[model samples]
Target chain A: MATGDIPQGGDTIAVIGGGLIGTSWSALFMAHGYDVVLQEPAKAAWPAVPERIATALRQIAELAPDLPAAGQLRLTTSLEDAVEKAVWVQENAPENVPLKRAIYAAVEAAAPAGAMIASSTSSLVWSELSAAMGDPARLITAHPFNPPHLMPLVELFGPDPDRLETAAAFYRGLGRTPVFLQREAVGHIANRLSSALWREAVSMVAEGIASVENIDAALVHGPGLRWSVVGAHMAYHLGGGSGGIGHYLSHLGPSQERRWQDLGNPALDRATQDKLISGVGAEARGRGIDELEAARDRALIAAQLALSGQRP
Target chain B: MATGDIPQGGDTIAVIGGGLIGTSWSALFMAHGYDVVLQEPAKAAWPAVPERIATALRQIAELAPDLPAAGQLRLTTSLEDAVEKAVWVQENAPENVPLKRAIYAAVEAAAPAGAMIASSTSSLVWSELSAAMGDPARLITAHPFNPPHLMPLVELFGPDPDRLETAAAFYRGLGRTPVFLQREAVGHIANRLSSALWREAVSMVAEGIASVENIDAALVHGPGLRWSVVGAHMAYHLGGGSGGIGHYLSHLGPSQERRWQDLGNPALDRATQDKLISGVGAEARGRGIDELEAARDRALIAAQLALSGQRP
Candidate 1:
């Protein structure tokens, strides 16, 4: 892919896999003036992908009124066509290792030697997946939070140093901040933290410590907002000095340690599992999956725009 | 002391700790039509407290546009006078158990016999602190989040169940949702989850897994927003049919155990502690203790009001 294949002043990206993440990648790439070519499995996913991308763009427009004219985005059905001569190929496919291995092999075979093949896989080990490719060094995980168009984070990881750097630069080009999981860890960063919290929440509910609504209320009404901005470390950092986290830990650390020890490791017992399923199913009562997912996409776009200081 | 002396439809609250929480409690009581007499030992804490309280009240007013009236909040120097004749004593004293024990004993002796003495201690066991009061049962931990006026969560716990219920009702009357923490725990619901995440973030930073800004960005841009609405459990619940805690655990539980084992358990070593302190201090460089606290209080008030549908 030559610099000319890229838009005159802006970059061009080819997002392979026009599913949920693929659509988001397209919108984000296009929003930044990247001519995007999204490859889907068949004609079946074509219409839905555009609709999803369009809805997100509309939201991006709403959240950021000053956003630049979005780049041109098109959909395709051929992987070879999408990757041929493309500056960047962001593969958003099934997270299965075997499947990723296959797709990456093809991506490596079809794309120009210089084109970066970025995987949007949230959990697969980068080295293992990329090793199957001819130039394993070219593949890097540019894992965006769900609804890539909105969320500002992109967890980048790969065994190869140059590949990781290129992937990071590409994401930055799209106004997305790429966070390197310097080491490949399961669930990467955010999901791992979330999984821990969710485990505790489920245990609390299963143990009858508090109702589901009460727990949700506790968070949304408490640190959720603060965490949204400064995060736990920074929040605690501020919380410690001036008597922030440090003050808290010193005064309350021992107590926290004691509690930590007592927090009975509530494994997923059959009863607890039932409690969680029932509890969550009840919570999701009326919302349609498609609608909820669309809403998530919009929220993500708004969040991304907010972080980037761009028009959503 | 009869319920009549408790003041029908009205009462005064002596807030004996004029820190961030004390001021917020003052605003909350004042907003609900109760006169508040806030007492802080540090005379230096005087000027800033009132200014912060005023700012918080303005935000409270904006959120709860129909808030009763303004003149309900007052500051005082006499701790004895603050508690005298008051129906409720909200002790925002430091987290030190001995200090709280001493304050509780004094406040318990000072306030009307029927009055409730509530501690805002986040981690201290209630039974230990309550043991010091004249009517130990009257004491309870009404742990409010930072900027209590804004955040509506109050983790209520006590040695006595009846008293716990009464305290819960009292907080509910003040427009705060009190979740009964089954027993004393570190960080309570929200903070515990926060601590776990912060610990992970620290480990990640220590390991160079990601940058400070990128981790924070991931949260605010992703789960943070979702958490602000439905929170962790509900989020995983909607992750898929086989999602939520049960499915997550069954599918990824071993992985969680693996990750937990892989997680760095760095002690609060002197160097690391200082690193945290300096890092956070750098982030909060320009904002003084008072200013940052006030800003936090105001934002909390707005958020709390928004959660409770009281925000204008």
Candidate 2:
């Protein structure tokens, strides 16, 4: 991988939206000593996103002392200005397909032809998102977890394998680990796995077998930590010890089949709805989305920065 | 939860055993300021486990400066002296039914009735383990995650309800959050959830749907982080948004049902075994059990200390 070709110096990178993710992108790029140009026409999300970004940058700066200065990010109201002459454009606009198409058209017009354009869409397929772009090959899903300034992972998915490699290099240039998904599934890699687990968790809760807190406890204290390090396969592989995954599976496989058969298949009923709402509301204790999101962002920043060392 | 009930100035809490979970228990207790009395007869394990525990404790001390002095933990060979009048006895013996029964019996004799005897058994039912004890009530499963010093959760299980409360109170006193299982199940909560996921991951790997690393990436980068806070049910609730778990269940539940039906119940074939091993081996290449363990302990300390602030 020609990591050096991704530009290490002060090349301008445009952040096309100033929402939580866009501002986080700006802070991350600036931290790596890139010149970030952030544009937010909403006028309202302005300053708020940047301010939140500032708090995150300060934490990152403290935690990662050797990291390059992240104080060079500039915010503006003009999308054209942000996109012009940039080496890379990271679009974090709203997920409305039509609006994204218009934004991509505008970005392609404003940015140089050689510049890379990546979307931060969590669910939208790259084929659909980049269809309107002049050079759709460079348009990939460079989806970072919440508070990108902190979390070290970026899920890279799209057509154009070569461009995906280039996008991966770009993120790695900024000290982010990129996992290239082989296909453009709805949830991509992380969300799909998460959706699977969440599906079972919903079934459990809806079935009245476990409460929200208990279920969360089951994960956070239990396999959650293990998953953070070794993940499922490695964990069970080690769990099998010298026997490896095969021997372990041979012994435990039937039990798993049994459990699967016995597992509850929860459905949406009046009982389930009330149980879920009451369960989550009690756990949340009625915090609004903004407050909960802000708190989650702060925590996620701390968590991702902590795991940055484990980047392989 | 009475936090101050914890001894203000104990240098060592005896940890009997030097196995994976045992070593983790030693490191965490030591990391939290109590000196650890690690009693292991296996001379090879003695040198390695303490070194591992010390490395882990130091990492915890780095992330959380408030972590008490861990320098006081000591290793010894005498099981008799290890538990003599100790404030707490954390037993990490082998998981055999007879072994647990015998160890707790000895531990009951060595320590005062008041001194807590906690087990790190993942699968053994508490009633069986505590049956031979004079005070069966004192024996409770403080089933910690592997590398206990790092993971923030301890599953508290016992036949006696009052003792379970006491065990919970004691773990809480030490800045650890304890979740009480109303009744003992085979793997407790977290492992069971993980087993379910691992079973599915194995099925996926067996079916050639995704590689091992891809599956691991999907989880750690995606729902894993989300599970750290809100857990599975809440994630679905959020995923379903205003539709709630009820709507999600009615709509997505059948799809999961379909997936469940489609799930490959392949026996642990040779190819399947090889795939799981190759996948996990590649992932575990750089990270030894010791290194990943220490990191896990540090994160655990950080999480538990953070959560301790939330307790009323």
Return the clash pairs for model 2, or none: B11-B35, B12-B35, B150-B296, B150-B297, B150-B300
Native contacts present in candidate 1, fraction: 0.41
lDDT of 1 by residue, B1-312 (tens): 442233323578889888878887887787777888888888888988877778777777876788676646667787778889688888888878898888777776677778888888876767778776667778877889865876777887777777777777778777777877766655567776676666666666666676665566666656775565556766665465334446665776666556555655555656666665565555565677667655554544443333343210
**lDDT by residue (tens digit), candidate 1, A67-152:** 67887777778788887857887888877888778877777788777777778887677777876677676777777876576666
Show model 1 residue runs off by greater than 4 Å: A1-12, A31-35, A42-47, A66-77, A158-175, A241-264, A282-312, B1-10, B41-48, B72-80, B105-110, B132-137, B158-175, B241-257, B274-312
- TM-score (0 to 1) of chain B, per candidate? 0.85, 0.85
lDDT score for residue A86 of model 1: 78
Per-prediction count of colliding residue pairs?
A: 17, 5
Worst 10 residues of 1 chain A by lDDT: A303-312
